[model samples]
Target: MLAIRTKNLGKEFWRQKKASGLLGSVRSLYQQDKERVVAVRSLDLEIAAGESVAFIGPNGAGKSTTIKMLTGILHPSYGEAQVLGLTPWQERQRLAFHIGTVFGQKSQLWYHLPPADSFFLLGRIYELDQRTFEQRQAELVERFELKEFFHVPVRKLSLGQRMRAELAAALLHAPQVLFLDEPTIGLDVVARQSMRNLIKEINSLGITVFLTSHDTGDIENLCRRVIMIDNGNLVIDQSINSLKRDHLAAKIIRVRLEHPVEGLPPIDGAQVLKHKGAGLKISLDTKKLSVDELYMRLRQLAPIADITIGDPPLEDIIANIYRHNQGGGEGHELEQEVAQI
Candidate 1:
């Protein structure tokens, strides 16, 4: 069963176009010029029940707009959408019972209250029975490891602790779907990993997850499928592995030499990105030069104490997708692939 589906879904906003300078500003009050900005365009998407999907794009890429439409926070300007078998815009109140949303920059919890108090307040909001609410709260607190700080005021809790509490509060009603927007935005490494693990565990319990995040680690570790959009248009919808395989063709080779190196030998497809005493970093185009060939050449240059080769970061892969679409190079191919997928 599909948890969420959309057909040709789109959104637009009308804003007053401001004029520059004092004279223009004075005239603008009476002469209001307006322009339409397309936040999302012709989006077709389907997410299966119990699937974890990542919806990602650069800033101003309509990622948040799409989520708002899906969650029924905003109505689409065109087309149709059904979330969990109901029209989101028309059945928003009914649909709210089955879904939960967590926005990193926004808080649903009461600022001055403890998480325990907020959980009970949410229970009332969801109209959960006293016994059921208590059971659910206990279960979530245990699962989210919130015992130590559950009684602490939200304002006094650490960011990580507060996030865990926020998630627990969202799940108080036993939602079937969870929409997470940058849930780990400000967390440190340890906290981020903890949150990821908790989210993974939650998804394992059969809730559908639709997530949006700028952190590559969140997408790489949590989601199996990726839906990428840019400039208000869908760029690609593919499995995470497929995205890495197709776009990540470059490799970085970092070498620590036994002695300081003067210069690197010229290689056709490899460029020295950085060189310092006893250390060298080279960027290699794997499509042009094989790793074995590069290694052989490096051996000939100097005695190598240690060497490590890794693919370019996920950020680079996503950037390359945007660049390809902006240049009008491989976007057509990607659209075709998305259709097949």
Candidate 2:
């Protein structure tokens, strides 16, 4: 069964055109000139049940618009969509019963009340019986380790503690599909990993996870698939492994040497991106030279003090995709048939 599906789903808005200066401002009262701005254009997507997928893009890329349409908060300008076999806009009330949402920047919990109170409120809203609510609440509190701060006022709870409570509240009713937006935005390292583990456990229980986050760590740690969009256009939809294998041909390595050298000798298939006192950064093509091979060559040149190797930033990977798709055209259309679910 498909958890979410869309075909040619799009959204448009009309912005009132205004001219500059005081004279233009005065004339705007009499003249109403508007321009059509497309937020999402001809988007098609399919997400299978129990799949954890990341919907990602830069700012103003229509990611929020698309999510709004899916959650029935905003109606689309054209096309159609379905979430869990029901039309979102038309069946919003019923849809609300089966889906859970968590936004890192926003809070569904009551600010003045404790998380326990909010959980009770949510249970009542979701129509969960007393016995069932208590059972689920106990399970979540223990699993999320919320016993330490569960009764504290939400306003007094730390960001990490509050996020844990938020997740627990969202799951109290046992939702089938969980939509998370920047779930780990301001969390510390240990807190972020804890949240990721909880989310993974939720997905393991057969719930579909739809996540959107700018943190590459969140994407790498949680999602099995990636759906990238830009300028309100579908750019790529493929498995995470496929995305890495196809686009991540080069690996970046930054090494700190124990002692500075006069000049480091070059190695085949590796480009020295940066070199300074006791520090060197290199880009290596895995297709031409293995990482171990480059490490061996580097060891002969200088004693390594500290070294770290990983893929380039996610933004760079997306830029590479854009370059490959439109051939570096600024306004070119991305009409290529890329991978899909």
Candidate 3:
């Protein structure tokens, strides 16, 4: 089942034309010109139930706007979004009962009160029975490792601890769908891993996750699929691995030859990115040349001391995608060979 789906989902913001100087500003107030900017263009996406999907793009690429429309925080200018069979904007109040949201940049917990109090308040707001609330709270606390700071005042807890509490609070009602926006933005490695595990556990419980993040680590580690958008347009909707395979098949060959090679080997279709002290890093354009051919050419040069071959960084892949799609899905379609699982 598709827990969330959209068709032609879009939103536009109206901005009054800013005047140049003091006189222009004063004149503009009397005769203001407003232009409509499309924050999200026509988009079509569907996320299956229990799927962990990452919504990633550069700043102002409509990640937040998309989430806002899906969560019913903002109404779309055109098109529609249905989450869990309910139209988000039309059935917003009713939809609240089935979804939870966690925004790391924003905290919902009271500053002076401890997390326990916030949880209790949420329980009452959700009308959860006392027994059920206790059970759910206990489970979330244990799973998120909140035993020590569950009672600490939110303002007093570390950022990581507070984020965990926020997650626990968001999941207290066990909503079937979760909307997480930069949930691990401020967390360290340990806390980030904990959040990842929590997200996985939530999805394992059949809760569909819609995550928007700038951090590609979360996407690579937790999400099997990724949706990329730019200039408010849906650029790509594909599996994370498929994206890597199809757009990033090049084997980054790093070699430490026995002799201090004067310069990078002139291998066809390969570009040397770095070279120092008998070490060389070359990015082989796998589509144009095979690894076997490159290796054969290297054998004539000198004995190789050590070599390492690996996939390119996810950040690099995303940057390339952004650069390649600078014209918004219209130019420089660099397709990579699909990698075998």
Task: Give one digit per residue, the lDDT tens place, for model 2 in 1-341.
Answer: 99999999999887677779998899888876676777888889999999999998777778999998999988999999999998899999999999999999999999999999999999999999999999999999999999999899999999999999999888998989999999999999999999999999999999999999988788888999999887788877998888887899899999998898778776888999999988989999999999999888888978889999998876678767755655535543422222211
Q: Given candidate 1, what's the lDDT at residue 6? A: 95
Candidate 3: residue 277 lDDT (0-100) = 75
lDDT of 3 by residue, 42-125 (tens): 889999999999999888788999998998989999997899999998898889988999998999899999999999999998
How does each model score on TM-score? Answer: 0.92, 0.86, 0.93
Model 1: lDDT to the true structure: 0.88
What order do you get sorting by TM-score, best first? 3, 1, 2
Flag regions of model 1 displaced more than 4 Å. 257-259, 323-341
lDDT of 3: 0.86
lDDT (0 to 1) per candidate? 0.88, 0.88, 0.86
How many backbone clashes does every candidate have?
0, 0, 1
Cα deviation of 40, candidate 3, in Å: 1.6
Better of 1 and 2 by TM-score: 1
Candidate 3 ranges beyond 4 A from true positions: 329-341
